[model samples]
Target: MAPRSRNASAPTKPLLKAPAQIGSLDAAALVGELRQLHEDAEDPDIERMPSDNELYGALLYAEKHAKALAMKQGTEAAQRSAAVKRVLLWEYLREQTDLHQAKAIEDARAVKAEWADLAPVLAVSTPNAAYNKAKRLQAARLIDTAHGDRRLRRTPEAVVEAERRIAAQALAERRAEEQARQRHQLVLPVAQRLLGHRDGLAFDTDAEDWLDEMAAVVDDCHTSTQQVSLARYLGATVRALARLERQTGKPPATTEAARLAYSAAVELLSR
Candidate 1:
């Protein structure tokens, strides 16, 4: 048979095998496998190399799993921090009132309610602001008591100098308080105007127009302190409007009023 032609023989078919369970592998093992797959893919003689698409998919899944684990860890950490803060707050309340746990907790709730009530007056909008103010007030109390009767035995000149310093600090504090009060007064009329719009009591003036005018006035405030005060007042006003909305169940009016107030605050602060 003309020495059976070698080229006429049937070609052998390569055996197909199932892919490895990459998803079942741990991260390190998956990475190692991927590295080997990469090396195999780079080699010109290697057949049956892992597909680049499959390796990429495994890498993406691994990265996603790692991110999810990190997020879970972050959430746990935040929860722990919040729990610690609560414990510290409760302890502080107990020391202040010398109350047992039950009473202290009850008193703490009452204090929180009082803070809510004064939020509008003090222009304390956020929980963090209230917490910081509480800490500052505590520190001030400690400082005031630190000198106590120790200043009674100084020489005449020293006593006079100390008196002058005390007077100066007092004057500065009073001036700051007065300035804040004046800024608050400037905002009160705007808040009242908005409230009138909410209640349909403002004559012929649209709520939005009044809000714009108030914003213009805030923009005109030259000092940083004045701008900050206006922003804080607006934030408090928005919170009050929100509270009123909840009480009245008039979502449209209350929601719009809050939106305008918040926008005004944001505008002033951004400048």
Candidate 2:
């Protein structure tokens, strides 16, 4: 028998995944699909396939089939089919488990989990055992083409590389947050003006919904993508309030503050 590489048969998830279920899926059919998924993972154009939940459900059914095979409850052909399904399912599960174990270890490290803390949880003898295990998993590089392992050891260089990747990912997230804060400056005055009059600022029934929505939308705008649409709302409010100022020539105090917010909004939009 040949020794299986930890990542050889593990497949990357498909791009567009649906809910995975085992409704009426039998062991025979699942075995065929298990082979197909392994093959499809090698194909660059594979855009769609069954997700992990489907395979997990199939493995549960295969377990039942395995019990029947043990009791000699099926015919020779049926027993052979069951045995093959069990083998394939076990192989798939083993590969998937290794990939996820590496990820879980990476996640544990993110929260400052030291090797000493991980040893007992990983069922390893000592902190060094845990460190060695992480190093081996880190070498696999499954996301890279499945040609060869990077063969990274638990040296300072290898640990630093992993830590660098983690830090870069965290920096990307912080950049996203920073960009959103800058974008929301476009409506920050509108939010503040409305908040200043936390009591309803609507001068009449017609302006009520727009005034309330302008404030709420700015408050809820946490992402850069959402800022553009919310700015349009603030712009419309400015036009409406400006018209109200022209018509009445003596608008209420809250309306006056909203008009001031319009000036701030104009400066932000010009930027």
Candidate 3:
């Protein structure tokens, strides 16, 4: 008989590891390595690249290995290697700083921060200077191409494109925020009503003790992110309640308000 095709087989290995427990890593060991490396091979551009964790780690690893290699060379060659490394890093950071600075300005404007507030931080003498710097950085990020090494164009057309993009982003954020607020306002009352019967129906039986904490959290919430847990808790609780009710010939809620709340909570579970 011919052997079965390997591709069609169920296979010999387990498909999952539940996160695959391999060699373990810890933060203290990684931080110790970076701290030691920084003592000798410090790169100032590391701070400028804070938004990119993966890139920062890769650069640090590359630096560690390359610095070891450079040390094997004579002193003069090592110095030259270090100089080239710094210059190449500078070129990369020069491009990235403009992009990140532009994003920071957009984030500041999103929170209604004024140029006056940003002037000192931007290292500028006046609010006008700060605003102009923001515009320049903003334009630098959108130019079609770099004119030369360290020379990025800020043409009128690029500035217009940047302005349009910023405006659209701000508008979308506002609309999304408003929609979240509206949805929260609508569902919040229903959740509160369901919790109103919590003492009489929910706590009477041995349901999870977390309902108490969830009630307090929902009561104090102001944002949609904070409010998500209440709906999720309610949805899960109602499903459990339904299963219990079906297994025994008894309803989860006996009182009129509670019966209504059970149905209401279940109906909005998918929402």
Please give the lDDT score for candidate 3.
0.59
- Pitting candidate 1 against candidate 2, the one with the higher TM-score is 2
User: Model 3, range 1-271, lDDT digits (tens) per residue?
Assistant: 9978666422222123221121233433343444344335444433432222443454555454544433433445544554455445445656577779889988998999998999998999899888878877765555222222222234334465445655787799888878768767766777788788864454324344445645767778787667666656666677667767877768878788888987887777666
Model 3: what TM-score?
0.45
In candidate 2, what are the lDDT values of residues 1-271, reduced to their tens digit?
8987674321232112222222233444665554343333342322333344567655554454343333433245655665676676666565556567888999999999999999998889899988877755654432221223232333434544555656787799788768767777746665566456635343554455566666676667765656756766666655665566677885434556645655565566667
Q: Candidate 1, residues 1-271: lDDT per residue as tens digits?
A: 5776564322211113321111222334434544343333342322333343454444443333322322332345533443443344334443433224324333565766555554454458975554444433332112221244232221233333444566788899888877667666556555545544554322123334444544555645656465555546556545554455566565434356645644554354344
Q: How many clashes (backbone atoms < 3 Å, residues ≥3 apart in a chain or on different chains) does model 3 have? A: 0
Give each model's whole-structure lDDT.
Answer: 0.43, 0.56, 0.59
Candidate 1, lDDT over the whole model? 0.43
Clashes of each: 0, 0, 0
Best by TM-score: 3
Indicate the worst ten consecutive residues by lDDT in candidate 3.
13-22
Best by lDDT: 3
Look at candidate 2 and tell me the lDDT of residue 77.
61
